[model samples]
Target: MIGVSVIGAGFWARQMHLPALAQLPGVRITSVVATSPESAQRAAAPYDEAQALTDIAEAAADPDTHVLDIVAPPDVHLPAVEIAAAHGKHAICIKPLARDLDEADRMLEAVDEAGTRLFYAENVPFIPALQEARQLVDAGDIGTVFRVKACEGIGEPHSPWFFDPDRSGGGAILDMAVHSLEFCRFFAKAPITAVYAEAGTFVHHDRTTAEDTAVLTLRFANGVIGQCEDSWSLQGAMDSRFEVFGTEGRILVDNLHRQPLQVVNARAGWSYPMPIAGLVADGHLAMLGHFLDCLRSGAPSLSDGHVGRDVLAVVDAAYRSVASGRREEIKETTR
Candidate 1:
């Protein structure tokens, strides 16, 4: 069994990772590190035999901890990973790995030098709906995927740092685009050749320096085209929709509003509390389970740091395209 040190007690940490990790076999959270000692303690209250602390160094240095699961913000990711590397612990980090390519390179270098098993925590491709869609595509139900359009638009995030460019990278594009960018690559099985993007702060203009909305056109090396849309201004429920067009057929998976179990009431109005989409479908458990399996059997996660870097590379080009007002060629990375 791999003992896990969970870094960050934020929303994703509490709502997703912790709950999922709690149920997975062969993995146990030994420690919890958060923004504050109190927060860490609060986060650890549900888990038996788990210690709480404010310092990642302490968590990583713990002999009982074999894996460092980082659910921290974008800015803190590399530093946490560095601690994990220094301690020679296996790591699973959330996506948009670093602020930029340089930071990502440094983190990759550190982990490589330490020989740490680093896995990028990207759960989009692991979602049941998306997995089924991929299976169909792989089986030639969609003969040759020529075009893909993926969109994720939700209201403002729960955290304040999500609005800051320096802390969270770019706004909607950086926060939500990573999902579509990575999943598009997964579906197409091709590297992005170029990207053209347009973004603006129509909403939340006064609230943040980053763009609140963005649309990117991605050209794959294998002649497939991808359209990615991201926004933080959508009203009401979130939109997690994808449309893939192939030579023989088409597939659409509206993951956001796919409510397998719905409820209606005169007092409370119609609602779907337990939506069968995204992490609610146990994607996080599947991801963590896969990582633990990798740790035990010497396999590799489907979404590793290299895959995360490549997706970031596309986002990097998209930001450049936003500035240049033209299609930007994706820079080749050695990793």
Candidate 2:
């Protein structure tokens, strides 16, 4: 079994990742590390075999830990990564890899220097509805794809750290737009050239100076334009959807709304809701399972730390665009 130590004990760690990790075969939940012993134990309570540790250094030094699964807050990601590299352990880091590009580069560099893999644990690509849309586009169901759009909006996040600029990066755009950007990049199948964005603190002014809602226009190398929208101030249902348009047709995938499970295949001429597992659970399960399989097979994952860094480049530009009130150029990065 590939022994894994999880480096967080927060909501995502408990509700999403830990449960998914338990369900994966050939993976052992060796430890759960948190800022405190109590938090670690609480997060690991469901797993009988998981030991609780209060610090990443202690968990990284443990010989049984072959991999460090990092689901910590954005600010702590770099430290956990450095520790994992120091211990020569592979890692699985969640999305928005770092608060910024410079930090993300360090995270990527450390793992690369150690010759250890850091799989970017982004579940958006593995979402069942989005995957179905991509397959149809690839199979020529949507011929010569040209335009794409992805949006995710929900009421304020559960944690307060999310609204803090220093800890969680740039609020809704960074936290939620990262998801839309991933799927948009997936469908475009090309490098993003430029980003035009607009965002402001429309709500939660009392909570943060950060933007609660944002929109991005992504220009892809393949001549396709993609749109990404994110909001923490959304007052309605948690609306998330993906739209892929091509010369021949369009494919629409909707998740978390009145017709949440609907996948409208323009080529097949169908718009029907199909029952599946819950969105959050299914996404984490597929992504973590894919990473576990890659661990044993020695295969490169679809979203490596470099890919996360690349996405951050867009995010970096988007924030700049928001500030400058002009379209920002995306600096080329090593992806």
Whose TM-score is greatest here? 1
List model 1 lDDT by residue over 1-335, tens digit each: 67998999988898888888888877788999998889999999999988999999999999999999999999998899999999999788898888888888888898999998789898888888789999999999979999999998876677899888889988888888999897788888889999999999887988998988899999999999999999998754467888889999999988745666655556544456774534546378788888888888898679788887888888899999999899999989755
How close is every model to the real structure, measured as TM-score?
0.95, 0.93
Q: Could you give me the TM-score of model 2 versus the true structure? A: 0.93
Number of backbone collisions per candidate, in order? 0, 0
What are the per-residue Cα lDDT tens digits for candidate 2 across 1-335?
88899999998898788888888888889999998899999988889889999989888998888999999899989989999999999989988799999999999889989989889988989988778788899999979999999989876787888989999987988999999999899999999999999998887999999898999999999899999989988753366788999999998887664344544344543233535445342477988888888888998888888889999999999999998999999988965
User: lDDT for each of the candidates?
Assistant: 0.86, 0.87
Model 2 / residue 177 / CA error / Å: 0.6
Instruction: Spell out the clash pairs found in candidate 2.
Output: none
What's the distance in Å from true for residue 268, model 1? 12
Stretches off by above 4 angstroms in model 2 are 257-276, 279-282
Displacement of residue 219 (Cα, Å) in model 1 is: 0.3
